[model samples]
Target: MSRRLLPVAVLVALVAALTASSSPAAPRQRPRAPSGLAFYRPPARLLAGRHGSVIWSRPARGTLRLAGAKRALVVLYRSRSLTGTPIAVSGTVWVPKGRPPKRGWPIISWAHGTTGVGDPCAPSRDSPTSLAHGYIDYVYPELSAWLKAGYAVIQTDYQGLGTAGPHPYLIGVSEGRGVDDIVRAARELVPALGRRFAIAGHSQGGQASLFAASIARGWVPELKLVGDASYAPASHIADQIKLVGAFTAPSPISALGAEVLYGAAAGSPAVSISALMAPPALALMPQLEVKCEPQLIQPDSFGGLAPNRLLASGANLGPLLALTGRQNPAVSIPVPILLAQGGADATVPKPFTDQLAGELRAKHDRLDYRVYPGITHGQIPAAAQPVFMRWVAQRFGRR
Candidate 1:
């Protein structure tokens, strides 16, 4: 039997056909933004907070009941981007009921995973039936579990998302600063909020948490960050780029390649979209920025990209690669770490996370790496909940 290498364009067209037929809204020209996110607009400059300071805060509409917490509100806070430019960020904070332990409730600064670079993709904008509601917002169960266990949860929307500007997706410094600054904003908003805290994240957030642990002492020295926990954290960016490039069609893997390219190009002025992607792929780059992850996953949204076509062959990826490597959780974490990885995770493959764990250990970073067999990337956080709760309890000196 003769075998033929599948043409990338054909594969993409097939994917598009499948997706278009399945999705009722596929016929629509422009995808609609997720519900409850259309009206996101922060004031021009509503009094700045020092770094993590809350510029202004208000009750988050329609989030209190869904979170199952005593109180929940959206806070528009101040955070600098990767380039150290002043920008407004938004996040949701849930305050649990009942009495505090005199020291106040310990905080769980939560960093979310990839939700697209679009402004409407912010986790705080999640609503009942929206895409974010399914992806990031559904974490209510996890957040509710923590609330029941008496830990306040603060979820950052990160810079550029939910407010204005180009979201610096996966830029460690930008993301980590957003995570750290939100905690600072939380403290300022909730007077009863405790200084003692832990950072927990899934996927991209996992990487952000690692970065947070490294920089917390210097960035926000006032907050007492005990430890960090990463669930299926992202690592090995150089290898990841290769993995994305290896895909031959318009699959989710290739979509990620396009997304990262867009992010890298957006973050650094040195890089240009046209320089990295071919004309066809470059034409679609603008869509990658405006659509949510779910929309992007729809095959029609991403025209199949040729292998190695999106990433320029001769372009020196050194600066971008260096930035990525720098964003990896350095072994310099001052506190202990709890990492949970899914053995069967395809998105963030087990080998990469295992290797990351080994690297952390080699640097003498305190790590409690736990692996759950048969679990996938999205399932790791919830699957490892029991372990996470126990580990977090111990970190807070609770039984």
Candidate 2:
């Protein structure tokens, strides 16, 4: 399915609204927490247990009606780091209102888009009026629809987003493991959930979904992964770095480039930050540690600097590029895949996803690729929602 190009004026308004909402001048409200900060900290001994084991959980707080979920929970589960170290991960589980099927409620493990690399940026930490709510408001309704359809939705905060460690950011292995392990954690907490599941994500999560599809069978053999869906997924990182390095003007998207570098450094000791970023970029590094995407994209932050200014004059991007290349989801995926792209997406350009879809096709992977003309990155999820919902239903034999 595809959409005809929208008017340029409409496109501009969409982008402007997104930018305005995330800008520094936006109204501020203290975000509500499902659990206290202490809940995120698990005992060292708990980390020694098998991956996906639930450490602890608490009933979800806030407006459950907004999500249309009957019961909600915030949980701390075990997962592995990029380097194979046992780590604790935080996430939320939302069960549908109706009675479960005799088999059980099918699971959808949701991997979210870029929310910055800081602990406070974790989506599990979002309340109705929180800083992240702008994007969440758009995405949660789709989740609520899935709940109404009787699918149990489990969203991972990934490794370190709300836990005690440097978030591996776009590091696929770490992100993918967190995506898959959370399903295990959810099922363990609620036995009413079935073993059959699908993985889905947008932007950064989109890339994570493909990575999870590639590794789910081997990583968590106990669970059955039926399909994967990606909405304007991030890909071709090496190419993006080269493109950003040539920029002569400030770009809000440059924050993502910085994130890629930071994530690479966090996931691997071999990737040196000092070698990858210039003094100018290094000076702003402290902000990446605490600020989420909205704050990071402000004019005074990463958005204020031209992409070229963020890197060293003769930076050695080999290590970072190689690590990210390994993360690209262009390779063969074992299950059927749904790949969506927006023609006007400025963040992950249409060509990047085109290249990725082409690669997947060449590999003979089961792929359903759709393009929505004039849709921006932020709009692709809603634009492609109906198609993906049906696709996911087919995967689970729903109707």
Candidate number achieving the greatest lDDT relative to the actual structure: 2
Model 1: per-residue lDDT, tens digit, 1-399? 224545766788999987543222211121222234433564555434368766556666765454547878787777777767678888889888888778888889999998888776888777765555567864678889998899999989887877887776777778888898888777766777888889999988898889888888888876789999998888887667755556665666556667676667667887666766666667777776567777776766664555456666676777677656665665579889999999889889998998999999999999999999999988888898999899999999997
Q: What is the lDDT of residue 120 in candidate 1?
A: 65
Evaluate all candidate structures by whole-model CA lDDT and list the values in order.
Answer: 0.76, 0.84
Model 1: what TM-score?
Answer: 0.86
lDDT of 1 at 204: 83
**Candidate 2 error regions (>4 Å):** 1-35, 63-66
Residue 133 displacement in candidate 2 (angstroms): 2.9
Task: Report the lDDT tens digits of candidate 2 across residue range 47-124.
Answer: 766688777778877743336688899888888886678899999999888788877889999999998888888887
Error of 1 at 388 (Å): 0.6
Q: Give the CA lDDT, 0 to 100, for residue 41 in model 2.
A: 83
Model 1 lDDT, residue 297, Cα: 64
